[model samples]
Target: MLLFRLMSALLGYVVILVTGKATERFVNMAASRGIYLWDITRVREGAVLLKVRLGAVKALRHIARRTKCRFHFERRVGFPFLYKRLLRRKALALGVLFFLGALYFLSSFVWFIEVKGTERLTVPEVLGAAAEAGLNRGMPKWRVEPGRVEAALEEKLPLVAWTGVYIKGAKVTIEVAERVVPDAEDNRPSHIIATKAGLVKDVLVLNGHPAVKEGDTVSPGQVLISGEIPPLEEPPKPGEEQKQGEEANKPKKPSRFVHARGIVRARVWYDGYGEAKIAETGRRLTGRSETRVSIKFKGKEIILSGDQNIPYELYETETFVKTIPQWRNLEVPVELVTIKYFEMAEYREELGIEGARSLAGERALAEAAGLVPEEAGIVNRSLEEVQTGHPENIVRVKVTVETIEEIGAESLFKP
Candidate 1:
């Protein structure tokens, strides 16, 4: 049925009203003569209405006359009549074609450029590098080679480790990742000290005297390895006894101080607290949005399309304004503004004690995990609820995390 309707519309069809005493005979004669008619309806005792293809309209006149009926066309539809109407108004047709051509031409050039994921390097620096590689704004998108831009960005900016270039519609985006350079190592006479309070899990002294052994509890700034190296004492000869005055007469051995280097593994504990409300109320977007576009000229605004009034009562709005560029001393006072409205709804949720506690524990654990070093080995984790004397509507949880990591830091000193 759909295909028949489409073919009928394409070939052009017409609705006609037949009047006379023999209208029924007219339809029957038309059908017998291989003339097709659809949507036939009896308007009155002596009149009928029906539709026929444009090609069969002349044939219907002969049938109508033979059946003593006179028919007149009520409506002319399909492409044939539409084409005739367009021919009558040539200017309107030309304007529509010109608009489409202009739209296609403007879409071929890049209008906006954005840089993402950039740190330590300014946007102008990245753009300058991209421009040198033929990826500038207003350039034809087909001419901007993404591979060439990526290589040039990494080469021109030494700090850029990697880059990604993307072209989407009329906008171009350049993303960059920076390289991280480690500080130089310092080697001087120093001692390795604890940066935090922790229990020593393992101690490996490489180039210094052990100030504290394994299983020892240490505080912040406490020396784990000493830079001072004591001189070795000579043992007494076999069966030889030395007097106290003879030892006093012996020359004193000088203590040597050197740079300390060692690995001191310790169990560091981090505590974090978090709270969640049992009953919470908040507003969030409902994921429904509408856009309104307008043009501003000479301090006046004219709406181009979209609804004049906002449909949502509680909604958030985001707007973007674009203006024509100035050339030489001439500037066009025209800009296009697009405003988007997003619908929002308020919601309330009831989380029981167990649910609230679970949420609070997750938050508390995340906070405690942030304190742990990336290279540290997590040994244990525990979560406990804070008990209060009075009743409250909030659930508070504390997280304690234990991780084994190297806590030895060098502390320099003079002899």
Candidate 2:
């Protein structure tokens, strides 16, 4: 049925009203003569309305005259009439053609250039490299060769380890991966200082003289490794007599300086406190929700969905509003509002003294664990309960954590 309508629309068709003594005879004669007619409806004693293809209208005129019936066209439809209208307005056709041509012409050129995966390299630097390779914005896409762009980018920027160039529609994307370059070794005089006050657990010297040994208690900012080395004294010759005046006249050699590097592991202690009540009361959501939608126009609201009255006795409402965007000074006073209702219920939990104390201890330990470094080794943990003379309904727990961790950090200096 749809295909037949589409065909009728494409090849023109007409609706006609027939009036005479023998309107039925006219329709029958037209159908018998292979001129198809449909939607035949009688309006009065002699008038009838029907539809026939445009091409068969001329043949139907002869059949109508033979049947002594007169027919008049009511409406002309389909593509033929549309084409006639378009022919009368030639400017509209030209405008449509011009728009299509302009779109095609503009789409052939690159309009936007985007750079991705860039960290050490700046956007302008990448774009400059692409420009040198003839891949800049506004350049013709046909001339943009991905292989050439990638090779040129890698060659121009030595820091770039890999590059990918892609052109999608009117936009070009340049993705770059930078090479990881190691830092140069520092030979300046420096020292490894303690970052925190702790008891020295162990010390391993790699390139500097050790200042503090194992089992030593060091304060923060204390030097753990010394960068300065005193000059060694040489033994006098066995046959030569040592002169005190000559030794006094000679200037003492200066100490050597170097960039100190080493590890200083120490035992550190952290404390945390937590308290919990034996009886806790709060309101929690029941996970049952309803959404209501409405439209507001000129200070009037019309509900679109959901019930007007809330079903839950205790509930929370969350409202969201959406409105048309304002352009220039023109604003539309219409908005779509959505309200969500979340049902809530009262909840109470009663824990005994022992249970409260256990919960408080766990919470205190968790709090102290956050302060411990990831590489630290746990040595010991202790939990203590605080006591008050007055009676109380809450339990307070204190946690102490002992961890062995490296506390050495480099500090540069000039000697």
- Please report the candidate that would top lDDT against the real structure: 1
Alpha carbon deviation, residue 109, candidate 1 (Å): 58
> Lowest-lDDT window of 10 residues in candidate 2?
180-189
lDDT of each structure?
Answer: 0.92, 0.91
Any residue pairs clashing in model 2, and if so which? none
lDDT digits (tens) for residues 1-415 of candidate 2: 8998899999999999999999888888888888888888998999999888899998987888798889898999999988897799889878878999999999999999999998889999999998998887788899999999999999999999999998889999899999987555477789999998899989998887889999999999999999987788888888988789999998999888888888899999989888888887778899999999999999999999999999899999999999999989999999999999999999878998998999999999999999999999999999999887777989999999999999999998878
- Model 2 regions more than 4 Å off: 1-185, 232-250
- Candidate 1 residue 357 C-alpha distance from true site, Å: 0.4
Highest TM-score: give the candidate number. Answer: 2
Work out the TM-score per prediction: 0.51, 0.52
- Tens digits of per-residue lDDT, candidate 1, 1-415, equal 8998899999999999999999989989889989999999999989999999999998887887788899888999899988888899999879878999989998999999999987788999999999998887788888989999999999999989999999899999899999986444445679999999999989999887899988999999999999998898989989999899998998989988888889999999999899998987888999999999999999999999889999898999999999999999999999999999999999998998999999999999999999999999999999999989789989999999999999999999987
Candidate 1 segments exceeding 4 Å error: 1-188, 235-249, 329-333, 411-414
